[model samples]
Target: MTLFVAGLSHKNAPVELREQLAVEEDKLRELLSDVSATGAVRETLILSTCNRVEVYGVAEAPGEARAVVFRHLCRYRGVAYGSVEPLLYTHLDGDAVHHAFRVAASLDSMMIGEPQILGQVKDAFGLAQACATVGPALHTLFTAAFAVAKKVRTETEIARHAVSVSFAAVELARKIFAGLGGKAVLLVGAGKMGELAARHLVEHGAFPVYVANRTWPRAQEMARALSGAAVPFAELETALAGVDIVITSTGATEPIVTLAMVQRVMHGRRARPLFFIDIAVPRDVEGSVNTLADVYCYNVDDLKQVVEANIRERLREAQRGEALVMREVAKFLTRQSDVEVIPTIVSLRERLEEIRVGEVRKALARLPGATAETREAIEALSAAIVNKILHAPITKLRESSRAGSSRSWLPLIHELFGLGRK
Candidate 1:
C-alpha cells in the first residue's frame, strides 16, 4: 500500500486554524464517507482533534489521493483550498508510518507524553472502521501503530509526569491553595477536560462541590461518577459561592460564566480567594471575570505554558519513545514491502518453472521411444534443478525480512531477473 498522511497541526497552524478544520465526533462518518466516495484512496482514516487534523490513506496514486483529501477537507470546513494549503504538511510511506506511531504514542502531541492521544487515535480508527472507510491495509497499519504505542508507554516514563492542560490546572490549583486537602472544587461542565480536572482534583484531595452542565442528566451522571452532588444548570451561580476552585469546559458558543455572575457570587463570600481554570476553546468562562477582586483565572493557553515548562522533564523518555517508534517503523515497512516483494518472488519462481517444464518436454520429445520411467525421471530432475536454483535467494529474502533488514535486495533481485516494475 502507498500509505500517506496529509494534515496540519499545532506545530505550524495556530489553534484558530486547527479548530476550523477540526471534525466533530458526530460528523466523522459523513466526512469519512465523502472521503471514500472520491475513489482517490483505497482506504482512509481521519484523525481530527483540538491539536491536529490529519488524514491517512492508502492509494495507488498518493499525490492524487492527497489532493482529494485536501479538497474534501476544504469543502467540508468551508475554506478555500488555497486558504489552508500553506498550513498543511505531507508525509509519505515510511515517514507516514513513523508519524502515525509517534502520534499514537503521544510523542507528537503539544504536551508530549499526554496519554489521551492514544485513546483519541483509537477512537478515530474505530469510527473509520464503523464507517467502512478502513480496509485491510489501514487496519493492519493502525493495529501495529497501537501495539507500538503500548510498547513505548510500558517501557518509557514519558507519561510519568503530569504533562496535560487538565493536570496543569490541578497543579495551578495546588499552587493557589498551597494544597488541596480541604479545597472545594466546582466542575462547571461535564466535558472531557472538566472531568479530567475533576479527577485530578479528587486524586489530590480536593472535593467536588457540585457538578453543573447544560444537561441535568449529564451533570447528575458526572456528579455521581465523581461522588459529588449535581447542581441544576440554572443554579450554577449558587454552587459557585461554596467552592474555592472552579474548572469550566463547555461547548456553548458564548461564555457561560460572566463577570457579573462571578462578581455576584463573590459578594456573598466576603472576598475569599477564587480560582478558575477555563479549558474550553471558546472559553466557557468570561475573560473579564479575571478582573474581579480576589479572583484568578487561567485559560487553555495559560495552562499550556505551565505544561510546557514540565515537558523538558519528559524529553529523555521521549527519546526512548523515538527509538522504539523507529524500530516499529522498520518492522512495519518490512511487512509492507513484502506485500510487493513476496508476489514478485512467486512470479519469478513460476516463470522459471514454466521454462523448466518447456525445456524438459522438448528434451523428452527428442528422445525417441522413451519409457514412462524415463519421462518421470526427466520431470523430477527439472523440478529439483528449479527448486535448488531458487532456494538460496528465497530463504535469504525471508530471513532478512525477519531481521528487519535487506529490503533493498528487492529492487536488485527484480532487475537481475528482468522482472517488470511492481
Candidate 2:
C-alpha cells in the first residue's frame, strides 16, 4: 500500500482555518470510520489539534488517498471543495512518514521541541484503534514514530526547557509557588492538555489533587487514574478555595470561571496566592480574573512567550533532531520501495522453478535404461544446480529493490530469464 498524509497546520494555515477543521474527541471515531469506509484508504488516523488537522492513511495509490482525505475534510467543515483545496497540503509515502515523525518529535510544532504533540498523536492512535481503522501497517508506523520521539527526547536536549502549553503551565506553577511539592492542584476540566499538566504536576511532587468536570464520570475516571479525588462541577468554587494551583482546559464556547466566581473563592482562603493556568483554546478563565489580588491568571497567548524563549535556547539540539528525522525518512523510503518489488520478484522466482522442474521430469521419462534410484539422484542434482544458478541474481534483485532502483533492473532481469513467456 502507498502511504499518504494531507491536511493543514499552523505553518501553512491560519488559526481560523485550523479551528474550522479541528475534530473534537467525541467526533474522532466516527470521522475515522467514515474516512476508512471510502475504500480508497486502507488504514486511517486523524490528528486534530488547535494548531493542525492531519489525516494519515495507507492506500493502493498515492494521490488517491490524499484526494479521499481532502474531500472528507471539506465535507466535514462545510467548506466548498474548490475553496479548501488551496489551503490543504499533501505529502506522499516517504514524505508522509517523515511528517509523522517530525510532528511526534515536535520538530514541526509552533514552538520547536514542544512535547504536547506526542501525547496528542498517541490519543489519535488510540481513537483510530478503537474505531478499527488502524491495522498492522499503521500500527507499526505509529509505534516507530513514538519510539523515534522518545529517542529524540532522551538522547538529545530538545526538551531541556518547557516549550508546550502543558509544560508552560508547570513552569508558571513552579515560578509562583517556588516548588510544586506539597501544593494542592485543582484541574478544572479533563481535556488532554489539562490531563497532561496534571501529570507533570504530579511528577514534580504536587499532592492532594482534585479534578472537576462537567461530566462527573469523566472527572472520577481521571481522578482515579491520577490517584486523586473528584469533585462535582457545582462544587468548583469550593474546590478552587482549597487548591494552591488551578489548571483549566474545558471546551466551553464561553468562559467557565469568571472574575466574580474566583473572587468569591478568594474570600474563603484570605487571598492566598493562587496560580491559574488557562490553556483552553476558547479560554476557560475570564481575562478579568487576572486582575484579582494574589491571583495569577495566564492565558494561552501569554504562555507562548515562555514557550518561544525555551525553543530559542534549544536550537542546537533541534538541529540534531532534524538530522535524525532525515535519517529515519531515508530508511522508511528504502523499505517502502522494497515493498513494491516483492510481489514481482516472488512471481518471477516461482515461474523459473516451475520451468526447471518440468524440464527435469520430461527428460527423466525419455531415459528408459535409468533405474529409479539413478533418476531420483539426477533430479536432486538438477534442483541443486538450479538453486545455485539463481542465488546471486535473487540476492541482487532484493538489494536493488531496497535502493529504490528496482525499475531499472526489472526489465533486464525479465528479458534475460524469460520469466513470463512460459
Candidate 3:
C-alpha cells in the first residue's frame, strides 16, 4: 500500500475556504466514515484545523485515493472542486511522511514554532483512533510524527521567543523586572490588545493589578474579569504613581500619558523604575517619555520590532528543526519499506519450505527400507539447499527496500513466486 496526504493550508487557501472545510470535533467520526465509504484507502486520518484541513491515508492506488479525497472534501464542505483544486497539495509515500513530521513539529504552521499545531494534530489522531479508522500504517506514522515533534522541541530553540505583540510586551517586562512575581501592573485601556497583554502579565504572576480607562464602566468590567481593582478615570495620574508596569491602548487622538505627567509621578517615587507598553495606533504615550532616567516606554511599533526579531530567531532555529525532520523522515521511510516487503519475504519462505517438505515426504515413501539416519541426512541436505538458494533473493529484497526501490521489483517478485500481494 502507498501512503499519501491531501490538503490545503494557510499557505495556499484563504481563511474563508479553510472555514468551509473546517470540521467540528464532534463530527470527526462522521467525516472519517465518509472517507472510508469511498473505498479508496485502507486506513485514514483527518486533521481539520482553522489553518488547514488534511487527509492522511494508506491506499493500494495513491492517485485514485488523492482524487477521491479531494472530491470528498469538496462535497463534505459543499465547495466547488474547481475552486479548491488549485489550492490543494498532495504528498505521496516518503514525501507524505516528511509532511506529517513537519506539520507535527509546527514547521508548516502559519506561525512556525507555535505549540498549538502539535496538540491539534494529536487531537486528530486521537479522534481517528476512537473511530477505529486508524490502522497499522496510520498508527505508526502518527506515533512517530509525535516523537519527532517532541525531539524537535527539546533539541531546538524554535519556541523559545515570543512572536506576538502582546507576548513580546510581557517578555520585555520579564527582562526589566527579572521576574513578574509581585510586580504591580496598571492597564490604562479596555482595548482587546491591552487586555491580552494584561492577561499575560497576570498569568506570569503580576499582582495588585489595576484597570484605568476613560470610561468607568469598562474599567470596572475589565478589572472584574482580571480579578483586579478598577481605578476611576480621575485617579489615572495617581494610579500611574503606584504601578511598576503600565500597558496603555486607548482610542485617544493625542498623547494621554505625557512626559510631564510621568515626570511628576516619578518625582515622589524615590527613583523607582517604571515601564510603559503603548499598543495603540495613534500613540497613547508620548514618544519623549522614554528619555526619563528610570522610565522605559515601548509603542506598538517597538513591540512589533521585538516580535520581528524573535520571529527571525525562530526561523533560524527552524532550519535546525527542518534538518532534524528530514533525518527522521528518512528513517521512517526505511521502516515503512521494510514493513511493506516483510510479508512477501515471509510468504516466499513458507512457500519454499512447504514444497521442500512435500518432496522429502514423497522421497521417503518411495524408499520404504530407508534408515532413520538416511532420512535425517536427506532432510538436513534439502533444508541447507533451500536456505542457500533463498539467501541471495532475501538479501536483495532487503537492500532494495533500504534503497527505496522496492516498488520497482516487488510486484515482479510476487508474480514470479506466485506469492501474496506486495
Candidate 4:
C-alpha cells in the first residue's frame, strides 16, 4: 500500500481560505468518519489547524486517496472542489513520510521552529486514534513523526526563543514604547495564548487596564487576579479607546474588532496611537483595520515575518534534523520489508525440519538393536544438517530487504523451495 498526505497549508493558501476549512476538535470524529466511509483510505488522520488542513492515510492507490481527502475537505467546508483543487498538494510514500516528519518537527510552520504545531499534531493524532479512524499504518506514521519532532527539540536550539505569535505581539508592543512600563493594556479574551501574552506584558512592566471576556465571571476573576479592572463585555469598544495596547483572542468566527469599530474608538484617543494584537485563529480583528492611521494591527499570520530574525540561526540545525528524519524513515521501511519475508522463511525452515525429523525417525525405527547413544548421534546429525542447509537461503532473503530489490527473486526462491500455501 502507498502512504500519502493531501492538503493545503499556509504556503499555498491565505488565512482567509484556511479559516474557511478549519475544523474544530468537536468535528474531528464526524470528519474522520466521513473520510473513512469513502472506502479509499485504509488508515486516516485529519489534522486541522489554523495554518493547515491535511489528511494523511494509507491506500493501494495514492491518487485515489488524495482525491478522497480533497473531496472531503471541500464537502466539509461547503466549498466547490474545483475552487480548492489547485491549492491542495499531495505527497506519496517517502515524500509523504518527509512531510509528516517536517510538520511534526514544526519545520513546516509559517513561523518555522514554533513549538505549538508539534503539540497540535499530537492532539490530531490522539483525536484520530480515539475516533478509531487509525490503524497500524497511521499509527506507525504518527509515532515516527513524534519521535522526529522530539529529536529536533532536544537536539536543536530552534525553539529556545519564545517566538510564537503571542510573544511576537509583545515584541511589537515593546518597539512602540521605549519600554512597556506604565503602558495601559487591555486583554480581550481569556484564551490561553492571550493570557500568556498578558503575563509577558506584565513582565515587561505594562499595567493591565482592563480585562473583558464574553463571560462576566471569568472576566471579573481574570481582572482581579491580573490586578486589572473588569469591564462589562458589552463595553469592549469603550475599553479600546482608553488602553494603549489591545490583545484579543476571542473565539468569534467573524471579525469582532472591525475597521468601523476601531475608527470609532480612535476618535476618542485623538491620535494617541492604538496597538492591536489579534492572536485568534479566525482572527478577532478585521484585516482592513491595519490600514487605519495611527493604528498597528498584527494578526497570527503577520507574526510569520517577525519570527524569521531568530530563525536564520536555526537553519543548519534544521538540516541535521531533516537528515535524521530520512534515516529513521529508511530504517522503518527496512524493518517492514524484513517483516514481510518472515512467513516465507519460516515455511521454508519448517518444511526442511519436517524432512530431517522424518528421515531420523525412520532410521531409528529400523535400528531396534541400536544403542541410545547411537540414536542420539543420528538425531543430532540430522538437526545439524537441516540447520546448515537452511541457513544460507534465510540469510540471503533477509539481507535482500536492506537493498530493496527482492520482488523478482522472492517468488523464485519460494517456488524453488516448494514453499507456498502452507
Candidate 5:
C-alpha cells in the first residue's frame, strides 16, 4: 500500500481559506467516516487546525487516495474545488512520512517551534481512532510521529524561546520589569490570546491576576481558570490603575483603552510604569497612549518584531530538530519496509510446506508395508528438505528490504513462486 498526505496549509492558503475548511471534533468525525466510506483509502486521519487542514491516508494507489481527500475537503466544507485546487499539495510515501514528522515536531507551524500544534495533532489522531478511521498504517505513522516530536523537544532548543505573539508579549513585559515577580496583571478582554499571555505572566510570577470582559460570566469563567479575580467591564479603568501589565485581545472594532482612559488611571499610580500589550486586530489600545510618560504600549505589529527575532533563533535550533526528525523517519520507513515483506515470506513458507506434505503422502501410499516409524522418518525428512529449500530465498527477501531493493524482487518472487499478489 502507498502512504500519502494531501491538504493545504498556511504556507499555501490565506487565513480565510484555512478558516473555511477548519473542522470541529464532531464534524471531523463525520468527515473521517465520509472519506473512508468512499472506499478509496484503507486508512485515514484528518488534522485540522487554524493554520492547516490535511488528510493522511494509506491506499493501494496514492493518486486515487489523494484525489479522494481533496474532493472530500471541498465537498465537506462547501468550497469549490477550483478555489482549493491551486493551494492544495500532496506528498507520497517517504515524503509524506517526512512531512508528518516535521508537523508533529512543530517545525511546520506558522510560528515555528510553538507547542500547541503537537497537542492538536494528538487530538486529531485520537479522534480519528475513535471514528474507526485509523488502522495499522495510520497507527504506526502517528505513534512514530509522536515519538519524533518528543525527541525534537528533548534534543533541541527550538521551543526554548518565545515565538508566538502572546509569549512575545510576556517576554517584553519581563524585559521591561527586569522580572515579573509580584507584579499585578490585568487581562482586559479575556480572549484566547489575552488568556495565554496572562498564563505566561502568571508563570513568570505575576500575581493577583484580574480578568475583565464585556460578558460578566466569561470574565468570571476565565478568572476562575486563571485563579484570579474577575473585574466588571465598568471597572476596567480602575483595574488598569491597579495592575502593572494589561493584555487586551477583544473582538472590538474600535479602541477600548483610549488615551484619556489610561491618562486618568496613570494619575492615581504616581508614575508607576504600566505596559499595555494590545494583541487585538483593530488595535485595542489607542496608539496615542504611548505619548504618556512612564507608560509603554505595544500592538501586534510591534510584537511581530520580537516574534521575528525569536523566530530567527528558533530557526537555528529547528535545523537540529530537522536532522533528528529525518533520522527517525528513516528508521520508521526501514521498519515498515521490513513489515511489508512479511506476507511474501509467509506465502513462500506455506507454498513449500504444501508441496512437502503432498510428496510425503504420495510416498507413504506407494509403500503399503511401511511401518509408523518409517512414515514418521519420511515426514521428518520431507520437512527438513522443505525448510532447506525455503531458507535461502526467505533470507534474501529480507536482505533485499534492508538494501531498499524489495520493489525489484517482490514481484519476481511472487511470479516465480506462483503465489497470488498480496
Candidate 6:
C-alpha cells in the first residue's frame, strides 16, 4: 500500500470551513472506523483540530482513498460535495510522508512551532489504534512522525517562543502580573484549549485553580485531574473575585461574561488587577471588558497577532526545522521503499536455492555408489556453496535499498539475475 494524505488546513481553508469539518472527540472513533471500512484504505488516522482536519492513510489506490475521505468529510460537514472539493488538497507517497513530518514538527500549523499539534496528532493516533483502523503501515508512519517532531524540537530552535493561543494567553498573563506563582487562576470552561492553558498556568506555579463549567461533573472532573477545586457556574462571580487570572473558552452562542458582570466582580474585589483571556472562538468574555480599569482583556484575535509576531521572529529557526523534517522524510521514505524490496529479495533467493537443489540432484543421480548419506552430504554442500556465493550480493542489495538511488539499481539486479522468467 502507498501512503496518502488529503485534507484542508487553516492555510488552505477559512475558519468557517474548518469549523464545519472539525470532528468532535465523541465522533472520532466511529468516523475513523467508518473511513477505514471503505476498503480503499488499508490503514487510516484522522486528525481534527480547530485549524485543520486531515486524513492520513495507506491505500491500494491513492485516488480511491482521496475520494473516500473527501466524501466522508463532505457528509460530516453537511456541505455540498462540489463546494468542499475546491478547498481540498492531496499528497501521495513521499509527499504524504513529508506532510506528516511537517505537521508533527509544527511547521504546518497556523501558528508555527505551536506544540499543541503534537498532542493532537498523538491523540488521533491513539484513537485510530483503539478503533483498529491503524495497522502496521500507519503505526510506523505515525511513530516516525513523532520521532521527527521530537528531533526537530530538541535539535532546532523552532519552539523557542510560545506561538499558540494558549501559550500566548500565558504570555499575556505574565506581562500583567510579572509572576504567576501564588496567583489564583479561574478557568471558566472545561474545554480542551482552556484546560491546556490552565495546565500551563499551573505548570508556571499558579496556585489553587478554580474550575467552573455548565456541567458540574465535567468541571469537577477537570478540577480533580488538575489538582484544583470545582466551583459551580452560579458562583462564577465569587470565583472571579478571588482569582488573579480568568480564562474563558466556553461554546456559548452569546457572551457568558458580560461587562456589567465583570464590573460588579471588580467592585467586590476592591479593583484588584484581573487578567481575562478569552480564547473561545465565539468569545466568552464581552469585548467591552477591556474598558474597565485594572482589567487586562485579551481575545482570540489578540492572541493570533501574538502568535503571528512570534512566528516571524522564529522564521530562521523554522528554516532549520524544515531542513530537519526533510531529512527525516527522506529517511522514512527510504525505509518504506526497503519494505517493498525485501519480498523481491526473498523471492530471488528462493529461486536461486531451487536451481541449486535441482542441479545437485541431477549430478548426484549419475554418480555410482552414491549412498543416501553421501547424496545428502552433496546436497548440503551445494546449498552451502550457493549461500556463500550469494551472501555478499544479497547484503549489498539490502544496503543499497536504503540509499536514495536504490531505484536505479533495482532493474540492474533484475537484469543480471534473469529471475523473472519461468
Q: Could you estimate the TM-score for every candidate?
A: 0.58, 0.57, 0.78, 0.64, 0.63, 0.58
Each prediction's Cα RMSD? 11.6, 11.1, 5.6, 11.4, 8.9, 10.3
Query: Candidate 1: which stretches are off by over 4 Å?
Result: 164-310, 344-386, 392-422
Residue 308 local lDDT, model 5: 88
RMSD of 3: 5.6
lDDT of 2 by residue, 1-422 (tens): 67778888999888877777787877777677777888888888989999998888888885777777777777877867676678778887678888999999988888777778999999999999999999877887899899889988887888887867788789888888878999999998898888888999999999989999999999999999889999999989888888998889999989988999988988888868988888898999998988889999988898888787777778879899999888987876676666756766777778778988899889888898899899889888888988888788877877887766778888778888776642
* lDDT score for residue 60 of model 2: 87
- State the lDDT of candidate 5 residue by residue for 49-155, as single tens digits: 99999989998887787777777777888989889888889898889999999999999998778899999999999999999989998999999999999899988
lDDT string for model 6 (141-254, tens) is 889999999999898878876777898888778888879999999998899989999999999999989999999999999999899999999988878889999989999889
lDDT of each: 0.86, 0.85, 0.91, 0.84, 0.90, 0.86
> How many steric clashes does model 1 contain?
0
* Residue 166, candidate 6: alpha-carbon lDDT: 90
Better of 5 and 6 by TM-score: 5
lDDT of 1: 0.86
Ordered from best to worst TM-score, the candidate numbers read: 3, 4, 5, 6, 1, 2
What residue pairs clash in candidate 4, if any at all?
Answer: none
- Which 10 successive residues of model 3 have the least lDDT summed? 65-74
The local distance difference test score of model 4 is 0.84
Winner by lDDT between candidate 6 and candidate 3: 3
The Cα error of candidate 1 at residue 65, in Å, is: 2.4
Question: What are the per-residue Cα lDDT tens digits for candidate 4 across 80-116?
Answer: 8887888889998778888999999988888767888
Clashes of 5: 0
Candidate 3 global TM-score? 0.78
Worst 10 residues of 6 by lDDT: 402-411
Give the Å error, residue 371, model 4.
5.2
- For model 5, the stretches where C-alpha displacement exceeds 4 angstroms are 164-202, 205-307, 343-395, 411-422
lDDT string, candidate 1, 1-422, tens digits: 48899898889989988888887877878888887888989999999999999999999888788778878877888978897887888898789999999999999988788888999999999999999999988898899999999999999988876677888788777777978988998888788878888888999999756788888999999999999988888988888989999888888889988999998999999988899999888998888888888899999988888877767768888998999899989988878766645886797898788899899989988998999999999999999999998998887777665554545777777777777774
